[model samples]
Target: MCYFLGAMPLQCVSGIFVLYSLCLLSFSPHCDGGNILVYPVDGSHWINMKILLQELHTRGHNISVIRSSTSWYIPEESPLYTSITIEMDEDVEDFFDVFLQEHLRAQRDGTSLLTFFKLTKGFLSMIARAHLLWSDATNQILNNKTLVKSLKDSQYDLVLVDPAIAPGVVLAKHLKLPLVLNVRWITSGEGHFVLAPSPLSYIPVPGSGSTDNMSFFQRVKNMFFYSLVLFQEKFLVGPIYDAMCDKYIEGGCNIVSLLQEADIWLFRSDFVFDFPRPTMPNAVYIGGFQCKPAQPLPADLEDFVQSAGEHGVIIMSLGTLVNTLPKEVTEEIASVFAKMPQKVIWKHKGEQPSTLGNNTLIVDWMPQKDLLGHPQIKVFVAHGGTNGVQEAIYHGVPVLGIPLFFDQYDNLLRLQERGAAKIIHLADVNGDTFEEGIKEVLYKDSYRQNMHRLSRLHKDQPLAPMDKAVFWVEYVIRNKGAAQLRTGAYKMPWYSYHSLDVLLFLISSTTLIFFSIIVMVRYLCYRRRNTKPKQS
Candidate 1:
């Protein structure tokens, strides 16, 4: 006899029955399975999300990633997750390339004034590019009936969004899913403006590079930068976001409002890496969370490190965006490495300089974490990317930073302040200067000791960053949304948040009382003088 239970076949032989339980179990979803949709901004953003999402997948979640077609950091194919590619126009990609090239060129050749102008222009261009990209993505999602239907049908339990890019909020709102923010930078962007406390008096503005212990003038400067950021967000980026939402998002949501609805915020920084600041319960710091145990190096690479002997080794990488350096700069770097006693492994995509050093090995790519974790590494020569800096901290390696742009300067500055790193600007990077920087970091025991101290602090968290991220992610899914964790400040108006209304009322009342007393005293004096005027 044959029987079926929920599409499972059962067999009865000689009055004994056997059920095909394995088949049912194989078809069933993991006990903690939940559909998670991730919207990443760019290649760099994707790299950070990839780490957190991979962990989520390992813990029985179904993940789907949506990225631009022109994204450079595409993840390897995995049966456990799915990828959705969105098309970007060739012209748009070309504009970004040209813009970055011009900016780098300006930094390489121009004076400070010229560089400032070029950076301003570059920032404007970047804003335009972001607006265009978000607009295109919004239109694509709204216009494609099949894609829209498939997305709605997927029934995602939660959405992991890169708050740097505004379209993620639109997608989450469209799907009506609980939102989780993954901030890929050390500095808080719009997410902090909405959810986190940002007191300009102590907390330096993102690009200011100032520390918490600021002088009176420095605090004024910090306040200026904060105001500039607010102006840009409101007058510049606001219109673009509003237009995009007005076209696609029903009821036309504001970007800040959308972000404030987020259930959890994961920042890519820790107290060790970033200056101490007040954070809300919903905000979780997961700096170096992407770092993992070092795998054995490739045989050839292992042999190269081993060959260095007692002199140790240094790793030079400018992160992903800066794959190629100017030929002159490259030659200078190579020449500097040639004189160093330690072996150098540089990640360079440009043509090898004619003066390339014999002591230096240039590879197109490297497993940076693995190389940093190696016992042979003496110091890391980096562009001061957050990921690179955090990895260096995790491995307890001192850094020689040659910061290029954006948060790289601030990141390097923080490390420099922490006594773990030194920075050499790109314009100041010559053979002699580069060599001096490397020598200082390599010879300085203080740098190494400080790095080790920070590493201990970073590792001393109650829950590992990955586990904390995973737990919160699951918490959002289990609880629908963690509204209780949200700060009440988000709902307060700007006047109420800063107590400006109360201050203004007090000032107005005091002014009114003072004026009334002065007028009454003047009238009494005038009346007394007039009554006695006849006798005078």
Candidate 2:
């Protein structure tokens, strides 16, 4: 048995090494360079992290990881990762696997809602008692005497922090190593951009650029929606993330501060999925990092698709979250497909929608990328997920996006404006609208042409997103800190960046004063014009 004590990989016994040497005269590949430590939000992230780690190792860099026990609903019986094997404490490993198994099973059965709530409550509890929790178990993990001692012993060079589980940032700060943060979404900077209401009417959206063409009443409704989102963030999300990171992760252990103290920032987006990049210097859009189509579809499925012929095919999926929208919403979407001229292939996790007809093949799951690559795939109807959007662009497939929440709406709008997709409101969505949207996508040569152009533009780039991410990551390690790219804007308050309320106040005050002046001038003019008024 090999023993992993802290960070060192050691032989359990001298006699075992001797025995192994006697049995085989093979040597392990020589590992080199500074060690890298990774922290991600479990499951596929773990898998992706391991893949990167192995690639780094192949280039001769030593690596160690501190992954969370949570699996985020991926099945437990499945292997942790395909590329590398990890050695963890047996008890910890067992607990993690068992937790994943139970949670994943519940997720499959649609009973994970209560479990999710309970976990959310615990997270809230930890946040509420952050000071205590910080000084105790959670914070200790980051600055654990054992882990730090290991890193110091190994002389690890860089630390990668996943903003999702960012405790490692505190650890990085404590150790004073180069830090890198992996931003998953528009979570930072007050959460108002896409999540909040900013004169961005969300509910009764008529089309992609509806705001630009909206009536005054429509604008008012949009502003109302935007304001409600801001209220939610101000009261809820902002405080929660702060409480989680500030008190518990960093302050107690000095790990997160180290992470925030990191020299480089990596924003994962290829710009294919998002439009008009955020104005952060170190932030690079590395989305579509996993854009490659993994494998070909099964022969039987290929034949079925090929048999469909000139009618073409429509692929329908709501991505992972809201995979099961309300039955009404599903029926509306299905009815639209029923009336469509194309054959539809719907990737639904629930029971087959009753409205689906002979032309529609309602399956529990489909090879998303593979289906997109198919010549018969005419259009995509998706929930405007980052991954889905990227895939559609990669395969030159046009989309009908029905965004549900978060960045999905923004992504859909961006694609719609680019003429590669169309957006429909989740609330007022129906069969007629869906059918009309599909017809437009099919008849509109611009959407297909634009998607093809985008695909070419993406491919013509100097480097792949993954390559860029890896390069920048290495640059940080080689240069100690990528401070040249850091900007002064990071130091400013959130209110200053977006002067929305300030502008509103100025407009309101100016209108009030202008009206007052106009009223006074009119009264004076009337009195001056009539001598009888002056006498009165």
Candidate 3:
């Protein structure tokens, strides 16, 4: 009787398990016509988008991607993990290479940290034209009475716009669908420096005080330099960008304006890096969303690292854009590494340094994420790019950030502030500073503890970033743009947006004026009394 009772329930439990497994299996393949549109092009965007698309395909969600011709044209050397080979047309390749060459030139000139700021503005303006043209083209395609009639004729549940390629914003506006804006970095206000005037805060004067420190002659010269950029953005950037879109694609479409209306704004960095903004709910920090790296290291690199013994090896990478170090600086760094207690593995994409020290292993590329996960990697010398920063934290490795350009300073500073890393000034990146920063990161227990603390926080995320991104993408389809999470800050005035600062300034000014009037009144009374009389 007891055996028969147990067997009856066992069959029922098995039946339920089989049904659940079949349901999961039904949803797992990539198909062509999904009810989603992804845009604003980048490798990261493509990678994350592909994962979400794959999951959607498995789960039976339809997905379509709209990108610039050059969006997926990455060379084999860059670290991209995608199953599909992104084919690019010849004209697109030409346009992309030209843009890339110009972009590389801008990075090379951005050697000093402060100068990097100026160079970044020029670089952003350069890319902005390409993006504007691309976005215009995308919008034109979407607005084609035939295409629009057909798409509206059918159904696209939602629009997913990657901030990099950016045209997703335009299509979202045109389609009038709920928009999900995926920001891969510190975009938003920072990207505006390309199109708008730089505030007085961007002016580089030595003193910590106000802009009033400059001599009259120097201030005039600085103003001229500042105006040159402002004038260029006002007359050239906005108009030329407008003209390109107006002629080729959509008329009067602005990326920033589109972002203001996005149903959700997603950032790739952790919340610790993003400021506490009012739109915090719509702003989700989905950092380190990529598939986990396998524990095994590259056999060749692993063997080499193992041979180093107790000293361990240091891994250095300045990321893809600035992969090549100037020979002079490379030699100086090599000099320091040669004398150090550790072995060095530098990812040098250019020619190997002529100096060729015995302690260093210079390779064209290293699987950064995989290498960082390796047990043998002792310390990381990095450029403090967002991707690199997150990887370092995820692996609990200490970093020495040699920031070169574009939000790198801010990233490095944030990491340094968090006690996870040390910063090496670009101008001072000679042997002493580089060596000292490295030694500190390698030797310090506090640095390791701090990085571990962040790693724990990163791991403790409510849901993995990839899962969160995929869930949100599907949620947008089901609910038509997670509108419940959208804050009304988009409609607020700029002054009102920064109201606390405005209030502080007003109160300080009013207090100063009131005190001055009081002093003046007392002085006048004393003067009149003195003149009228000692006689009284």
Which numbered prediction scores highest in TM-score against the true structure? Answer: 1
Tens-digit lDDT string for candidate 3 (172-271): 6666888876675312233323222334443322111113235666566556555654554455444544543354344554445556567776667665
Candidate 1, residues 228-290, lDDT tens digits: the string is: 677666776777777766876788877777788889988888889887777788898888999
TM-score of candidate 2 relative to the true fold:
0.64
lDDT of 2 by residue, 1-536 (tens): 33553544554466667888976755532223656766554533454455455556666666665533333433333233221112222223334444433433433344354855553344333333422322233454643567557667777678876654444555566667788766553222221143223334333322123424457787775565455444433554445445545654445422222333557666656655554324455666566665675467899777777777888888888764444666776787787777766777887776667887787787777888889988888889888876788888888899888775445676787778778888876645667777778789889899999888888877677778777777777778778877777654444456765777688899999999999999999999898888564444
- Sort by TM-score, best first: 1, 3, 2
Ranking by lDDT: 1, 3, 2
> Positional deviation of 272 in candidate 1, in angstroms?
0.5
Clashes of each: 0, 13, 10
| Runs in model 3 lying further than 4 Å from the true structure | 1-34, 43-60, 71-121, 139-154, 184-254, 275-277, 291-293, 492-536
Model 1 gets an lDDT of: 0.81
lDDT values, one for every candidate? 0.81, 0.61, 0.64
Give the Cα error of residue 403 in candidate 3, in Å.
Answer: 1.1
Q: Tell me how far the alpha carbon of residue 37 in candidate 2 is from the true structure, in angstroms, after superposition.
A: 1.7
Please identify which of the two predictions, 1 or 2, would achieve the higher TM-score against the true structure.
1
- Stronger candidate by TM-score (1 vs 3): 1
- In model 3, the worst 10-residue window by lDDT is 78-87
Task: List pairs with backbone clashes in candidate 1.
Answer: none
